[model samples]
Target chain A: MSVVSLRGVTKRYGDTRAVDDVSFDLHENRIHGLLGRNGAGKSTAMRMLTGQEVPTSGQVRVFGENPYENADVLSRVCFIKESQRYPDIFVARHALEAAAMVFPNWDQDFADRLVEEFRLPLKSRVRKLSRGQLSSVGVIIGLAARAPVTLFDEPYLGLDAVARQAFYDHLIADYAEHPRTIVLSTHLIDEVADIIEHVTVIDRGRIVMDDSSENLRSQAVTVSGPTKAVEQFSDGHEVLHREDLGGFTRVLVSGVPTGRDTASLQVEPVSLQQLVVRTTQFHDAALAGSGNGNGKGNGKGAWS
Target chain B: MDDARPLFQQIAEQIEDSIIDGSLPEESRAPSTNELAAFHRINPATAANGINQLVADGLLYKKRGVGMFVPAGAREKLVERRQEAFGRSYIAPLLAEARRLEMDAEDVKKMIDAWRDDQ
Candidate 1:
């Protein structure tokens, strides 16, 4: 059964529809990657899921109940975003302490360990911390909260490679001991490619793709060879991206290679990040061609 | 191993290599998926998938809630599978390269003898 479900969930701000008619389910004990380009509505969707924002015209359910202002359901969910705000007087440890007060399953020892790993200052005011330090605070809480459902929206804003790796390590370790639903919204698809079992790619306030990572990994492949062979193979499938170099052509297409003879073309699997970028680009073009595309242009680049 | 192959498949192959090489002997506890994930910096779920595939292949078995372990005869089974794969993965390419170099089977046999002696 789904622990969280969104049906036609739409959130609007003035004339802009940040999340438009989006719907998906976060299953129990599953790690789902909520992926998309900047301003592609990933954050909005997450906020909606965490009940920070209400859907304008659809249903959003958490534990069979609305999450917005629903303390019973909200208590079981943790939403950690990069831009998380703390009180003016609050320090790094203070934030964790406050979260511990609310979360029933908070593990103080785990929090303390994570605090050391992330090199977070215990007594430093939240606002005085470095960018990476601020990110660490959020990550520390998200992991230590042990919420039944946790949503992390680009929570590793300024963390270094080592710090990011430490987060992934701690996550996998803690998760093994205690199974829970984890939805990580990130642009670093390749980094987390092996981590996510399920993937959901959103673009321009719409869900472009959703499937098991295994299925997605096998379905899309980049084929390169003689121009004619590549074109012939790509003709019927949905081509995500294509590049040409003189007589050689490479096309990224979504479909299984089925034939008695496919020896002429060299096919390779597309990385999750590549697939998402290409797919969102294709979605972008389609939206542009349709002339009334709900382009958020929220300025969140894939890398950022 | 090809990096293009799925991450879980690569992980499974690594564990299989360990088993076939006698490092992970029969009846010994294999590392948990989370342990492998942390060590390799991959997702624990993907590591779990790879281990689960081994379980399905009969090379590994679960000790209830204890952990996954190599079942008896797993090494022999893997050796049999590897030998079956040898002809296609190694021999075929070797023969093709020999043919391109204009070396007959007898000539290749002599070369193998020379290589063995030098080694």
Candidate 2:
């Protein structure tokens, strides 16, 4: 069942619609990847969902009830972002203590273990910590909070590759034992491609793609061969991207028929990152072709 | 881990490879979904889906409160099925590449003989 649902949600700031008529569901005990480029309104949508920012129009529902100013709903939700702020005098330990008090499911032992694993300095002031150390503080709180509905928005801002891998390992290990609804919003799509069960791609305040990761994995393929043969094979499919080099042509096409004969063409699978990029570009091109001019104008150059 | 197919299918194939290679013998307990997920660093739901596919195919069976187990003849059955698919999976590509190089079946047969002598 869907634990959280947004219906026609629109968050506007001044003249800009940060999140435009967005509607999607977060199912129970599943990991959802919210992905998009910078300035694509991913943060705005996340803020509205966490009740930090209310939508100008439409509804934001968590656990079937409005999350705005609802302590009961808020307690069950944990929003961790890269820009999380603490008091000037607060130390790392104090932050953990504060989180332990706020979250009913907090585990002090888990938090302590994470503190050691990340090599966090508990006595140091929160502002004095290094960038990676600061990110680890948020990561520890987010993990040990164990909220039923946890949302992580770009939680690995300054973390090194090793630290990020450690975080993913810990997350998978802990989540296997304690399942909960998780929304991970990040630009590192390939890193979490296997970890996430569902994917939602947002672009310019609109959702361009939303589906289970498994379904999206097989949705597109890249066919490269002689221009005529490649074009003929991808004739009926939705071409998301195309590149030409002399007589050779390559196209990324979606909705390809399974088991189609491709004896002359080189067929390869499209990675999740490539799929998201191509889908966004395809959406942008469609908008620009319609004379809307609302897109970022990057789409018009992709066709060449 | 391959990008060419769904992750769950890859997980299932990994388990199948273990079973076929005698590492995971028939009648032995199979890895739990959590074990697979933690080992592969993938979502538990995806690992569970992989296990469910094997169960649906009758290669693995549940012991009800115990855990999943490879059936008695799972290895043999898997080997037979893989052999059936060898033509499409391996030989077809081999022939396709040979055709591209302007080589006939007789040439491929001679090349295979030469490769065997080298081995």
Candidate 3:
């Protein structure tokens, strides 16, 4: 079932089009990844989904109905941001209490367990919490809300390696018990790539790629061989990315290699992060080569 | 949870999942390192390391001539092992944290009830 859907949605900021005519369906009880480079309109798209930002055009639906100012839908959705802000006087317990009251399906026991697991200081005010602790607080609330649809926007800013691993473990363990729609938007693509079932990649205010994580990983492979053989094999194939390493050429192609008589060829599946970075970079180069397309080339060069 | 354990330990649970789901039936040949590596986009060495860990634990055995196969009675053993580890790994800390938070047994039950009511 589609828990969230966007059809021809566009969000504009004065002269800037933050999100342009984007459309996708997020299914229920699956973890989805929303990925993009900075300023790529990922955040804008997420905001529109949560009704935090009004769409300039087209439709946005959550749970099969328009979510704009709809308390019933909004109440069942929890958006955990990178930097969660609370009132200066609000203590950790106060926030937890407020969450318990606000979320109709709040799991206080789970919340309290998470508080202890994260080692949250209940008496400490929100402003005094460290960046890692703040992220933890947001994660605790999002998980404890038990909302049908939960969106986490870059919730691991200052978390150390240990803390981040803890977050992943707890998320998987809890998710096994209670399946829900989890949309994780993060730049640490490699970290959550394994847990996500599907992914949507946005670049330059448009949806460049959206597919199952399994297919995305499997559909592309990097083949490295003699430059001549590589070029010959790559002919008529959709090359998502390519790299020249000394005398050898490595090309990431979208599709399995078959019927090749070349003896000196090696092919391997590309990592999810590698695939996304290479794909977005490839698109950028194509756009730049066209010269008239979305022409805001920074010239620092794309993903050297 | 320490970083010392290989990152694939976190993913090895998936192989266990295959066993539970009958994807890799009892005594059936397990996936090869290259297959797993390609399927997961992981380093072949890391994939082998995960398989080796399971091999060391006796959940899987090598046939030498034919690759690896799930050990007989592996599923039952895994269940027993997981149930045993669940006590110290999950329940103990949970109860300790609850007691430390001043939540008595009755309070814990009440909290569960309130959560049910809210849902």
lDDT by residue (A150-184, candidate 3, tens digit) is 89998887788887777777676566567789899
Candidate 2 CA-lDDT value:
0.90
Give, for candidate 2 chain A, the lowest lDDT window spanning 10 residues. Answer: A295-304
Sort by DockQ, best first: what order?
Answer: 2, 1, 3
Which portions of model 3 miss their true places by more than 4 Å? A292-304, B1-119
Q: What is the lDDT of candidate 3?
A: 0.81
Against the native chain B, each candidate's TM-score is 0.93, 0.96, 0.74
What lDDT is reached at residue A139 by model 3?
84
Candidates sorted by TM-score, best first: 2, 1, 3
Q: DockQ for every model, please.
A: 0.55, 0.82, 0.02
Residue-by-residue lDDT tens digits, candidate 2, A95-148? 999999999999889998999999999999999999999999989998999999
Q: Which residue pairs in candidate 1 collide? A: A38-A300
> Which ten-residue region of model 3 chain A has the weakest summed lDDT?
A295-304
Q: Which candidate has the highest TM-score of all?
A: 2
Candidate 1 wrong stretches, greater than 4 Å: A260-264, A295-304, B93-118
Across residues B24-45, which tens digit of lDDT does each residue of candidate 3 receive? 8899999886567555544344
